[model samples]
Target chain A: MGTINVSREYSVKEKMFLPAIIQGMIITLKRFIQGFIFHKKYTIMYPEERRNYSQRFRGMHFISVDENKVENCTACFLCETVCPAECIHIVAEERDSASNPYGVRKEKKPLSFDIEVLRCCFCGFCEEACPKDAIKLSRNYELSILSRQEGIYDLNHLKREVKGRG
Target chain B: MSSYEISKSENYLNYCSDKIRPLPVTGPDAKPLPKMTLDGQVVEFVPGDTIMQVAERAKVASRIPRYCYHPGLSIAGTCRMCTVEVEKAPKLMTACSTPATDGMVVRTRSEKVLKSRSGVVDCLLASHPLDCPVCDKAGECELQDYDYEYGPSRSSFVDEKRVFPKSSTRKLSDKIVLNMNRCVACERCVRFTDEVTKTNDLVMLNRGWKKELTVGDEDKGLYNDYQGCLSDFCPVGALTWSDFRFQKRVWFLRGNASICDRCAKGCNIEVHSEKEIIYRFVPIYNPKVNAHWICDEGRLSYKMVTNSHRVIAPLLEVAGHGPTATSWETLIPVTASLLKNSSRALLVLGTDSTMEECENLRKFFSKFVQNGEIRYFNGTGITTSSENKALDHLLRQNDKTPNTKGVESLGLKPLDVAGVNGFDTVILFRSGRAGIPSVAAAKNLILWGVWSDEEVRAQKNVRALLPGLATQEKSGTFMNCDGILQSFKKAVEHRGYGLDVTRIIEKF
Candidate 1:
């Protein structure tokens, strides 16, 4: 692979400082007019205004729960299998006989479900692969954290209540 | 390699039922071979042939779907999946139980047959958990394959499905795990336990929608020697072998046909491996041998090959380090010198040794250890062919080693513990099937075959350990219990430091 990048030759007039300076000023003037004259804003006004996302927008993932507050996941591992980034890890165990009212219908339960979101590609494949509507990528895209450890979401973090892909 | 095979018997039962029902041969009394037209192809079949059998003979392009119609098991055509449209017949008939008459036109893939099959799949899937992702049988599940081929786009049942509370995640035996929710009530496992092993360990309780499979005796859960076959024949994710459950997916495995060496039965098996790591051993259909069923001991025998303690590397008895793993270059010259120095060398070939390996050893020793006395050793207690008999009606034999008869046929004497005394250097050669003999009389003992560190440590005055390939890792021929010669190619590459007989001999 030879470098073709060096072959492009700029005309003497365009290479001179004036043309480049004018192009830079034009971008700045357009942005200034849009912000001040038209009152248009590119950045969100945090703590006040929130951006609405489409239903299909893939973002932070959460597991859904049924009316009884029991998780919908039977630990079938479809999400883990379909996850392209290999961010999800799960360990399954049989539900305890004493507490399991659903019986063999919900026999298997994920003992621990962890998702290292940093490694996740936000692909929504897990959402599509899940037989039960348990794992879903929510519309809330604000996934920043203070530390790297917080980016790895556990079952507890995933089980928190979220409404309608939010 | 595919879901249909994992769920179906990899080999159709080749049990020739002719011996059991010996009809009269050529004469006016003898019945002519019946012919049937399956999918427009006419073929001749035996007098009492099922539609599926006729279809097989005709080499029909479309395979009739089946759930409880294992060729190895007695026919219980309850699944309604194999229903086919027979010309002049009013309704669809199950090909499994329906016998084919001469000139019968069977359409396996007609629209009517396909529609009925789709309806059968819907009924079977109504209560099914549809949990294929976590299922060990996902890739090879018969239900999954049939559903993809002929099932309705979605289930119609609106009501909640029935659940067997205690049946899911049930341990039928130490080897088998039963998930009743995944079961489609095919009753194949129940029949297998009843007719095949004759253990009667599994029984189906209740009726209709409330049916459940439970152990015959609650106290004893699946106490059969052939419990591994349940997992092998199950058409769904219901019955799974505990040894292979959740270890690896079925599609990811690479199967190589090999023979089991746990016993003299020489059960043919397919080594299911992924990345050279064996997942499990499933019996391949050999009507002459195992016939689609492998004992749990033979099925679990792959663990021995994959064991961490197996002596893969050549070990030398270092002065301070005990048996230390050393390269062949370092140990080969030393072993050669030991043979040269010893005035009288005795070679003890294990009964488990293949015919070719034994021949190579006999020739190699006669040339190398010129003053050596060669003897074959059968470590599994039984001394001769007269003592070797069937331990069970099935595959197992009294002689545990696979090739006791093979070595005996070589005109080698059995090791008489008292007669073989005061040898200078004794070489114990085996393929890990024979027992380690008490060769205490020998001044120097060289351990060969698949020896572990623990075994080498137990023996005294052992000079070196020449790690050799197990039966699965090498190409050789073993004479089975029935005096049947079985030649097997190397299934998987030798994962450890072990070498075959020829390779080890060349090093000498």
Candidate 2:
């Protein structure tokens, strides 16, 4: 548990440090030649051009909607149960009989569904646990917000039209 | 009051009965109990039990799948989900209907039996709506249980499921909602209404593919008083209790054993609660008390404990502000001064008070109110144990309060016809079971034990209010209408500022 200090004499090559600096300069020159001379671009303009990520990359969350813009989520609570961060909160209520179009299948709907984006670990367990394939993790990773309240997503924000994982 | 006097009594008979099997004793004539082999284990069963019951007695019923078979209901082996292979029988037999014989051998998990169960699930799921996400019984449904155990991962039939449009949104009673498409056609609810309640209010309408459940008389609807029990035994989400329809998912509740204080029957119940909030009360199986069923009144009486209007904080009546919330520090001394200043005080104990509570109140008031007339009031309309009778054939009692007999056993007499007229101060204490009595005579009034804000506002000359725990949140003993003693522990923590009897007494 005690600290030990050992001293050693430096060799001439180690103390001069000229060859070490030259070796580092050669590595940097190789990368500069590949980028400046060969024109192999390593960075892209974020707003104009975007890099493609794998389809399985989990980022923001969205609820899938049907043709009539109705969300497929039945407020099953599978997402809330499987969430490790416990960020998902849902309040379920029975759908109005007069307005329900899908009979008994979608008889219950979420009165309020909220997700604290800041608290979510994005482990993708919610996507795996969902039975109706309603809740999904999309590939849109830009999640920065100006206000603390904007980090919390409501049902209306989640039900926006998401096109092909974007 | 000492801590020993307020110690919560636990009913250890049921809680500690796990993992200990009873020894099979012989009769006086020296005949051993009947034995059967269920899934390689030798089990001793009663004389006239089915093979399914024998498997249940062996604690190996989980290996067998079931839809129509419920232990509380009568046998109707129509589902064929519980089919088992017999050693020497010609064909597979339904375990629910086949009686167990001596040395009978049965295999519940054989390949042939599993294939049969899988086929049964297929047939049952063919017409099922597959709407478990929206169903209230999703987590605890028996049909879903059997389907997961022995069913196909993917179905072959691609045709559309038949839908009963009218019966999909059927209302059997104000307490029950029906959705026929979700039913597995097990006929458990129909038989429950017929055999248990004996009401014959429900019946199956059609045959085979068109089979549907409906009230016997369409015009009359369901007339049974025990309609809540229908939702309990339903294997599917066909019938649901309206009170718990969309309140919470079943998996989120944490259950604790408690007694129903709605009546004197002392029905053992499991309080399903989450975050100190009670979602519903379900009956725990106790053959000595309520057997697998509770009346609608007792099942729904838990709302009184969580009512928003209940006075949860200690209150002191200011000169002009009326009964306003105040801390225990200020209210207790102010209350002690009020009782000390009054020349004569009358203490009224509600019959709803527990045995230990009544004793503590008697000892606490004896020091100050020397000439105080102490009396027990049961405003439930019955005066004595002889007058308390059964209101129905089941658990309902004519005397509404739970512990009239227990209070009377403490040698406390009933309130006089003259009431508390001459006393300068009147102290009334109840645990929410007894009715309010006449407090018009006294100049100074004190209320205790779970009163509502509206109730306090209605009463005049109220000096102080002390909120006390509800029965579910407190431990107490009751002498039921049958003269049987029952004790219960606190099921949930008190969410309000209410204190126990011992804690309240210590403040003084």
- How many clashes does each candidate structure show, in the order listed? 2, 0
Q: What is the lDDT of residue A15 in candidate 1?
A: 77
In angstroms, what RMSD does candidate 1 have relative to the true structure? 5.1
**TM-score evaluated only on chain B, model 1:** 0.95
* All candidates: DockQ: 0.25, 0.60
lDDT of 2 by residue, B167-190 (tens): 897778899999999988888788
Error of 1 at B191 (Å): 2.8
Cα error, candidate 2, residue B419 (Å): 1.8
For residues A19-78, write the lDDT of model 1, one tens digit per residue. 889989999999999999999989998759888767788988899988788888877777
Q: Is the docking of candidate 1 incorrect, acceptable, medium or high quality?
A: acceptable
TM-score of 2: 0.89
The positional error of residue A138 in candidate 2, measured at the CA in angstroms, is 2.8
Worst 10 residues of 1 chain A by lDDT: A1-10
Tens-digit per-residue lDDT, A56-139, candidate 2:
899999999988898889998989998999999999898898998887778788999999999999999999999988888999
TM-score, per-candidate, Cα-based: 0.83, 0.89
Error of 1 at B53 (Å): 0.9
TM-score top scorer:
2
Segments in model 1 whose C-alpha atoms lie over 4 Å from true places: A1-122, A132-166, B1-32, B219-221
